[model samples]
Target: MTAALFLTSCSRKIIPGKPVLSSTRFTTDSLPLSEIDVPLRINLKPLYETANKNVQTIYGSPGWPNDFEVVNCDTRYMYRFKRGPLMITAHANTVNFNFTGSYIIAGAQRICTGTGSNRIPITPWTPTCTCGLNEGERRVNIGFKALLTLKDNYDVSAKLQRLEPRPLDKCTVCFWRQDITSTVMDQLKVQLDDTGNEISDSLNRLNLRSPFQQLWDMLNTSIPMFGMGYLQINPEKLRLSTLYAQNDTLNISVGISARPRISLTKTVGYRTVVPDISDFNQRKGFSIFVDAVMDYDSLSQLLTRELYHKRVDMDKTGKYIIIERCEIYGAGNEKLIIKIEFSGPDKGTMYLTGRPYFNRGKNQVEIKDIDYDIHTRDLLIKTAKWLFNRRIINTLNHYSTFNIAAYADTLLSKVNVQLNRQWQKSVSTAGAVNNLQVMAIYPLTENLVLRCNIRGELTVRIDAFDF
Candidate 1:
């Protein structure tokens, strides 16, 4: 795939080779809340399923026809998403003014004031929730990166070789010779079966074989041995969204809607991580659109302020969002669960890079208006964050690269690939072994090509190599 080459980058941060942002999101940094209330409930099951399945499909899966015959792909790969690469450093301080002694008494301060008195003093657990963070700063990079690689089964050459039929003890076609020559010569009769049915069976068998092979041949012949070229993967989209520029756009787009499939065990190199709230305190959304080189420190800075510096938006009250958990997948596959928190839902749509009139750059290509509720709007924002995550960061995971295959198979000439994803599984707090399937496909070309005749569901399950 095209991503095979030029794949030497890190797999951390929302979008590698991009900028970091800040926000004025209200959070208690100095004091870790005894009970940190995370209002967002993340359904990682779908995200995990989508990502894991994609990893299998990308490597050309094994054993199965979709899998490669030869072990050409690297199975020990994992798709990881990170928060930031830009570390913030800052110096802040606070001074305590004064303190007063306090005492606690129960039942109207009934004190015995005697040596044999069974009385105790108590005080309410009241402490001024205050902290003076002296002007201090350290490099707290909010970026995230992981080591991941995509793999599949065997090589195509091997699969074809294995599919070839070998000789059998009993030849199904031998009866044809007997039927054609039996009644003619004495020598031919010696080889014929005792029953005259061989003659009839031969005719019937021939007729059936003709249509079957003919159909097979027809389908195979229809399969363009050539036309399109090598395929490519956009790990950015998390789906294989193949590129085929046969028309005016002069660029390839997704070709199929079939969900990419993969096995669980084939996937290797997994490393899980939770967000660092302490570090996240720095990404204040949208302050002044600046570059990464400037103000790379200040872990206390909000992400909203950070984005403002990038010129993505200019908002007070730090109009921004924080995606608690999301699966990184392809462009078109929306089979992911996302959790997002925004100061105001209005700015939620802007978190993603699409048409301003409508969000998600996708349908906006046609529809002029987009609508959403507060919760749904936040969900969309979370999904956008996931789509933005890419595995183009880690170097070690960047093994042999691949390009989008030019040729596609099937009547619709559909193609499926794994573009971008971060997959993993876990027994949820509710004890559900959930699966996540995420991918993207470029479905339209000039004038909407091949809109009909396409449908299929991709299934994926993780397996342990040792098993």
Candidate 2:
């Protein structure tokens, strides 16, 4: 419009003696600025290759990091029903990157007061988007209608390919069927331990406390499925909106607290696998499996039975299952090769460098790491002294009596207690102690819910490409 105005004004004030030569030249007079055409060089193959790689990274795989709490495990019986529980094993019926644990899987339910397959797109002309020229994005519409039932023998083996966790933009959820009985309904209520501590600490470290609290309040406001419990999670930059089970979609809304970008860099070496706890330039907080298991033994027993039944059934399908302490070694073979057990939506991994490598006195190398027995022995001896701290402390006190032999006999003989006594001490040399202030306060289980979400992944290669 401005260009048109300038051209119109020029035409109205045409000089009596001047004459327009060419229309192109005349149009140039009203142009905004001089234009430059720089020669361009682009390798389409590499450009498209990079784009494809990035797209695969986004859609091919998504998930949280895996952690196997090192402990021996054995399966036990929960309530040996005359047979096993009758349910649809995920092995038989599952989706790509799907996990098993009583999934109330939800699909696109064209939300509307009026609806039909003939739906409309609602992409609003959002005011301002800080999108860059090269910003890439995609949205996939996936849904299907079906009726699944649980038969008496739900034994089936299956493959579960894991996908990355995306809580913000995309809303993939497990919704309980409206027709489920109250008894079967309890299973849907059981939440996965997505490691709230990990999630919360990650949020806290990311300075997202306000938004995190807002989400908590929303979920706690009311139990979803109590009628039609809905868990709407929106994890996005700049803002977040979540609705657990509140009012109608109109009144129920969550405002996303503005957020920042996350970047990370790490260094690793032997002594400490992670030499620097340097915050990855990006927001750093991990999903800590904080579902406190107070009675370790009892909890272990419970999980054992659950896992045993699940896996026994999983094996029948012939897919290698990766569970805690499964002791998978001697790689190469796919059927028996599994690395991680459970992962959350956005699990993180801190890959430390260096390893438990043996250094044979300067140059003579070619040495294997310490044996597990040796490691356990060292730890047990230290643990023995720790379990009996009173005796150890009393002996150290008796050293003030100038009995070097007694101190050595009390501590050195059994434990490798590294000690360094300063010839003279400066009281203020060290920092203050804050034992009381450093409260390791655990939250009441009531405030926190235990969610047991699972992740599955199928590792495939980039076999072919298309333009």
Candidate 3:
């Protein structure tokens, strides 16, 4: 009778119920709203050169306007002006121009004879006398200021702040012995107005939308992350900061709102068109809430590689179990269900459940309160009491953890590669991730999601300015 009891106990087969656990809604209120500052640096030297070229073209050939009539009729003055190279400078969206040139004046002077009461004019005017003609052209300087602003439609508007003409050399009429430099400068102011208008118009016609659209297109796509997954920027809204000019370079910060994520597979979605420029809000750096995913299949393989075919002693008795295979999946109720198939004195399947939590000190995600499922406990109590020992439970719990710090490092490296690379000709990005730390963990039916906060600085560089 004792031998019969022993045989029955050894041959008893354990089968636990595999009841599906109800899913729980995992909500995280701390998931941050992402903000990325994409600093747009444009080479303003090209723009300045282009503006100067346009101005030169508008001025036309040298010795331009061989003669400009300032005062005609009885006491007339005709002026001729020549301009040198155009110099353009920009500071804080204000553009200034300096044109150094020379000028000459020639005109007839009025002649009167005798006293005022009985005066009679010898001639309506004396022979045309010139000033600064043979004595070399008199020096003059023209300066202008343009206040530039970004319009809502992305057009650049330049308002003429002030345009002044200053004559540096004297231009005295030979007979009149009067300096006409100020008078000549007054006549030249009209031409300066036209030049100012030309500049303003040129700036107003500048098309900034095309370049911004190109940047928008570049950012809207998915970027591949080696050994991790794909990153979708998922940009929502955008705003532009005021223009900053330094060392002949213009920098504009483009702030973006995004919901970024990492997926095990590439995600394809409808591409969004770039919207109009929004209100200006100055901000720096980036704060992103990124969902980093780990597929259950990958997690299972990682755990199985460490625990596969491992032998564990049940007790002092000769009885032992070898883990033939293991599978991990979400069992709902914020718990992870691990299924282990083993070969031992009793060959059967057992299930364990645990709540996963992040251990900040270890930088790991460890399973806590790990033990056999309720059904597994019931079956083990009846058939195989040896398998329900704490030693076995401890072994499973110890091996169920994953090092999140290492994963975060790998993820950052992969993401940085995509962030800091040349996107196309004359367009590139320079980015640095300050920190990417896991904030929360959620085990869903499909995969494990690690909600992370990524702080970084990103800048978009344009080597050439086409617009």
Number of the top-ranking candidate, with TM-score as the measure? 3
Better of 1 and 2 by TM-score: 1
Q: TM-score of the candidate numbered 1?
A: 0.15
Estimated TM-score for each candidate: 0.15, 0.12, 0.78
lDDT (10s digit) by residue, model 2, range 201-280: 22122222322233333222221222211222122221212111111111111122211111111112111111111111
Give candidate 3 misplaced runs (Cα > 4 Å): 1-19, 27-30, 56-85, 101-139, 167-180, 344-348, 374-389, 413-420
C-alpha positional error of residue 417 in candidate 3 after TM-score superposition, expressed in Å: 5.3
| Candidate 1 per-residue C-alpha lDDT over 1-467 given as tens digits, one digit per residue, 9 for 90 to 100 | 01111212432222212111222242212211111111111222332233223221111112322221211121111111111111211111110111111111111112222243333333332221111112211111111112111111100010000011111111111212222111122211222121112222221222111211222222122121122222211111111111111111111111111111111112122222211112111111111110001111121122223233221122333332332221111122221111122322232221221111112222121111122223333443454343222221111012111111111132113222221111233111111111111112221111111111122322222221110
Error of 3 at 233 (Å): 2.9
User: Cα RMSD to native, each candidate?
Assistant: 43.0, 42.2, 6.0
Instruction: Kindly list the per-residue Cα lDDT of model 3 for residues 1-467, writing each as its tens digit.
Output: 01111233545445576635666776544446699887888877767776676664333123334642423233556666667777777788887878887776677666556664555556666677876678887888888887778876788877885467777888888657677677767767766777777767777778677778777776677778886788887777788998776656778989988888888887785566788877677888999998877888888887888889889897777788888888888855688888888877777778888887888889898889988887788777776788888877888887989997887888888888877898888888888897987888888777888888899899898877576
Worst 10 residues of 1 by lDDT: 154-163
**Highest lDDT scorer:** 3
